[model samples]
Target: MPSDVSRSSARPGGSATDLAAVWAVFTDMYEAYLAGDRARIDAHLDPEATVWDSATPQLLLGKPALDQVRAQRPAAERAGGGPVEAGLTAYDQVIDVFGELAVCRHWLRIDYRDRPSGLLRNTAVLRRAHGGWLITHLHEDGQAAD
Candidate 1:
């Protein structure tokens, strides 16, 4: 978990731990994103998953497409010379589990080091595999900050 991010109470399957586990997958991904660690992010993604990223112009069909975007990051960002991400906050989190599948929805606010903060509404679908969770689908849309 990122020490800069605060975790909110989870709502899922009547088990806080289940939500905790699911939350970990995302927190881990967020940490990887901040570090520009593509491999770590890939580990949590399902091979056939889809992503509708907040800044992308079109839907990203799978891990390959996601990787392509990661590869296009600015050298300044990859080298840690850009504005830092002060922290991330999630609000109105909701998670529901059905058998081995789970769905999560939350609104995220990212506080940047020297830029205007950004907000995104996100949703994710996850499946249980190898005793862990993998994201099968993710959608993020930029939102106006309040």
Candidate 2:
């Protein structure tokens, strides 16, 4: 069984709608994070996905890494907390709608803890496989203030 119930496959379809569905998954992940819903965030992301940041000194790989991060949250604040709030400054996204191969570039400004208070740009590539869209790779590099 998957570590969390939310991580289980929620949808099963391979069509044009998958594009929007997959994108919704990404968006939901962000929203869930801001809401301090760690299970929801993990559910939306692939188990093999990697998280990285240009400013951070390490790369977080797979659900285990993400789970570890979530585990650090205090029990009282794990579900919903003021610190979970983040302002999304910008979202410049580009999506290539190929039948099987797609790439999405999301430029964002996040206010997570222990991070600078500026924009942090990121890119993600997704592939349609096994009747679903899976995030194959992602890279995020921070930009210092001018």
Candidate 3:
């Protein structure tokens, strides 16, 4: 039911250009998080989107919910005793575009305190909203395979 050309265009790694915008925004988000820039994170994330892939698996929906996440950053930092230094080891991202909807799968290796030596793979789905993109849903799993 689909033409070959269409199929080709829809492939995950179809064209580098096709994924540039989303990837840039996603990268920006990651940088903001790393820098502990709550304002920047809030600015990019949709008010109604949900962040589901945390250790607590939070369902952060609506502006208030997102703001709560922003608020929790400092508290979490305090709880953890200090700032976390994380470095990405591997990132294999796949972006699927369907008009204004996009889904991204990011396999990342994060260095955190609890598991300072293992890699965790996180998958996040984003959507285009209000002239920008926002993370709509996320699911992360800790992997020992690394």
Candidate 4:
């Protein structure tokens, strides 16, 4: 279980509402990814967002890189096929906001029905725009799941 469900910020200018919304952006994006909802996932991503995923070899930037990764999903998945079911959970979340920018760091555990679960050490940088938040950058490294 994650402690980020509740927000109590000690940093100046970082409010509970901001913390919750920032955390929500992380969860919301993963939920969309698991559900194969590309539109929803893109909704949370900044137009110029960059991501270094747990399995990727190089940093991915902008729309072209994003599209190429989507096209290369087959290479990343199982030889037979993809996961039949999967559940994503997070813990040890630290969310902070400074004006229009926020940083969210968390341990993400992804449980697959038959495949080995993946643990992600992730940091997401988000920018608040038009009353909402979009992921500006994401850095992630894979770890052995216990």
Report the number of the highest-TM-score candidate.
4
TM-score of 1: 0.82
Q: Count clashing residue pairs in model 1.
A: 0
- lDDT tens digits, residue span 28-135, model 2: 667675665767766655788887745345777887875676577577666555354355543555556566766666656666564456666777767776776777
Q: Kindly state the number of residue pairs that clash in model 3.
A: 0
* Whole-model lDDT per candidate: 0.80, 0.60, 0.61, 0.81
**What's the lDDT for residue 52 in model 1?**
94
Q: Give TM-scores for every candidate, taking all chains together and pairing residue i with residue i.
A: 0.82, 0.62, 0.70, 0.87
**Clashing residue pairs for model 4:** none
lDDT of 3: 0.61
Worst 10 residues of 4 by lDDT: 1-10
Over the stretch 1-146, how does candidate 1's per-residue lDDT look in tens digits? 33221344444453666677777788778878767687898899999899998868878999889878866878787678777898877666677877688888878889998999989999999999999889999999898887
**Best candidate according to lDDT:** 4
Please write out the lDDT profile of model 4 over residues 1-146, one tens digit for every residue.
Answer: 35455543435558788888888887887788777788998999998999997667889998689888877778546343666547888777777788889988888898888888889899989999989999999999898988
Instruction: List runs of model 4 lying over 4 Å from the truth.
Output: 1-4, 7-13, 75-80
For model 3, the stretches where C-alpha displacement exceeds 4 angstroms are 1-15, 66-76, 112-115
Off by over 4 Å in 1: 1-14
